[model samples]
Target: MAADLVSRVKTDPNFIELEAKRGAFGWTIAISMVVIYFAFIFMVAFFKDALSVQVYGVITLAFPLGILVLFSAFVLVGIYVVRANGEFDDLTKKIVEKAR
Candidate 1:
């Protein structure tokens, strides 16, 4: 019975839509994060002199860029959570209901 229900859900249109949407959205977020992180890493590796420049008293330019990279992860997760709770959850509910 469980297998049958799972098969039915897999064949459902909502399931397909959910899979495609989730996959694409996940990839987009992952790629964005990778680019942002790598850009910071590259800057640190290749542009130490620039990062070492004084931004304010006792603060270097690298300080804010590092903070931004950390905060960007949190912000991206928050965005994913919002979308998952809204669109993804709705599609999931529909798929389960249809399976039943």
Candidate 2:
């Protein structure tokens, strides 16, 4: 049964399209997050003095930038959830129905 399903899946254009779209979107999101995270790490490692410098009276640039990084994680997760629940879920349901 599983083999038959796999055969059907392999031949289906919709399956191919879905895989392509999902792979592309997943990789894009993954790469973006990695770049954002590594950028913060790199900044911390190489530009320690800049991050240490006071932005206002007492608050430093590092504090705000660190907060921005944390905020960005939540924002990125929201983005993925929206896409997965909406577009990706719709496509997945369509494919499953066709398989059935």
Candidate 3:
């Protein structure tokens, strides 16, 4: 019974759409994070003087930039969560109902 339902869901057009959307969205977020992280790393490796400059007393430019990298991860997660909770959930519900 479970296998039959799985097969049915796999054949559904909505299931295909859901998988494609999630895959594309997931890759986009992953690539965005990689780009951000590598950009920071490259800056550290090849542009030390720029990141080392003092932004304020006892604080360097690197401090805020590092914080920005962390903040961006959270922002990206929030973006995924919003879409998942909305469109993804709707499509998932449809898939499950159709499968049943």
Candidate 4:
């Protein structure tokens, strides 16, 4: 039964489309997050003095940038969840129905 379902899934066009969409979306998000994360790292590494300088009276650039990195992670996760729950889930259901 499992093998048959697997064979069906492999042959299904919806499954192919689902894989392509998921892979593309996942890679795009992953690359974007990596760039954002590495940029923050590079700034901290190369411009520590600049980041350490007081920005808003007492707050430093590092503090805000750190918070931004954290916030961006949450935002990215939310984006993935929204796409998975909406478009991805719909595609998944269609694939499953086609397999059955």
- All candidates' lDDT scores? 0.94, 0.88, 0.96, 0.92
For model 4, what is the C-alpha lDDT against the true structure? Answer: 0.92
Per-residue alpha-carbon lDDT of candidate 3 for residues 1-100, written as tens digits (9 for 90 to 100): 6888878888899999999999999999999999999999999999999999998998999999999999999999999999999999999999988876
| Candidate 4 residue-wise lDDT, 1-100, digit = tens | 6998898898788888889999999999899899999999999889899899898989998999999999999999999999999999999999888776
Over 11-68, each residue of candidate 1 has an lDDT whose tens digit, in order, gives 8999999999999999999999999999999999999999999999989999999999
Ranking by lDDT: 3, 1, 4, 2
Where is model 2 more than 4 Å wrong at Cα?
none
State the lDDT of candidate 2 residue by residue for 1-100, as single tens digits: 6999989977788778878887898888888889999999999999999999998999999999999989888888888889888888888888888899
Pick the TM-score winner. 2
RMSD of each: 1.8, 1.5, 2.0, 1.9
- Tell me the spans in candidate 4 whose CA falls farther than 4 Å from its real position: 1-7
Q: Per-residue lDDT for 72 in model 3? A: 99
Q: Judging by lDDT, tell me the better candidate of 2 and 3.
A: 3
The lDDT, on a scale of 0 to 1, for candidate 1 is: 0.94
